[model samples]
Target: MAANNLRGQVLSLYSRLLRMSRNWNATNPAETIVERQYIKEETMELFRKNKHHSEPFIIKECLKEAEARMTMAEHYRNPYPRPVNLPKRSFSKKEGKKIGKAIQKFNEQSRPIYIRSTDDAVGRSS
Candidate 1:
């Protein structure tokens, strides 16, 4: 759970940095390029460190973001191919049904705690 939180923090920071770069580009074109490059390098380094620990969704997002940014940085490099093909795995119907039931059971057990935590978070944030 602690590791997941840390990974979330890193992902949030990366997203913020990307937004800042886009904003900078619009307002300060000359400075934006340099700043963007610096941010890209820093983000790449941080991402590499946490890559193995990243969740599936985050890893996908990171790869997509990196490819987009790299294409922008190196225009001469051929445009990235559409529909990056990630490897797929298959499971039997029995396995799927078992997994679904397990998830449902877990959610049913944790729903109250999850709601309380969410309420607490909202109350604190506000």
Candidate 2:
């Protein structure tokens, strides 16, 4: 499916990024680091430009190559924000049904809301 291909592409891209980061870390020389970063940025940019037409196989292969270059030293940063201890929103089915019924009743009693076609709406504005 198209969704599966999209997921694969994203996963591959992340894997490739991690690998390149590891390789850059391993070299440690200033010039190599800069070059590596530049190359990685370029690769990401190219991917962004042509992502619409990119095949799943190409994405997966690129990711595998990138992963091969990755190192443990490059993995220390936290990829996610610290978890917030916020209370979760809870809603019951009965509450949802009640709200839906109320909205339906209000809509039925009110004048119909008209949404003009995009071209008609734009022409009226002009």
Candidate 3:
């Protein structure tokens, strides 16, 4: 029953993504065609490639990724994927280089730290 629900969710998300791609329009006239094509092609290719997976966890993860991408696209008004790493030019300045080294050290040293509110930590009540 849960599997059937997950399948339905995936199909619904896929349909919405396709509709979004078909209707995509960029603010820049020159980019509308390119961005629209990219959205459509990427959506179709990824959905087709992952259609064989029967695992609910994997499907949920994929759905989460698709939803996040849609939210980001709408928020940023751009459909292109974000870059995983900063461009080399970003580290060309002395300050930038220092910041880059700090980031690298942090990445190598530990897991991300999540800060909680003092009220939560102390279990405070009004």
Instruction: Please state every model's RMSD to the true fold in angstroms.
Output: 13.8, 18.4, 12.6
Candidate 1's residue-wise lDDT over 31-125, tens digit each? Answer: 65766666566555646554664455555444454545445434533222223222243222364355566544444344332122123322211
Q: Candidate 2 regions off by >4 Å?
A: 26-28, 54-126
Q: In model 3, where do residues sit more than 4 Å from their true spots? A: 85-126
lDDT of 2 by residue, 9-120 (tens): 6767666664664565334465566656664665565456445545665555444433332322245332111232322332223643555655544433231111111123
lDDT to native, each model: 0.46, 0.43, 0.66
Best by TM-score: 3
Model 3 Cα lDDT, one tens digit per residue, 1-126: 999999899889889988898888898989988888888888887777668778887677667667877887888998865434434433333553454666554442232111101113222110
Off by over 4 Å in 1: 25-29, 50-126
lDDT of 3 at 8: 93
Q: Considering summed lDDT, which 10 consecutive residues are worst modelled in model 3? A: 110-119
TM-score of each: 0.32, 0.33, 0.65
Q: Per model, how many backbone clashes are there?
A: 0, 2, 0
Model 3 pairs whose backbones collide: none
| Candidate 3 or 1, higher TM-score | 3
Q: Which 10-residue window in model 2 sums to the lowest lDDT? A: 111-120
RMSD of 2: 18.4
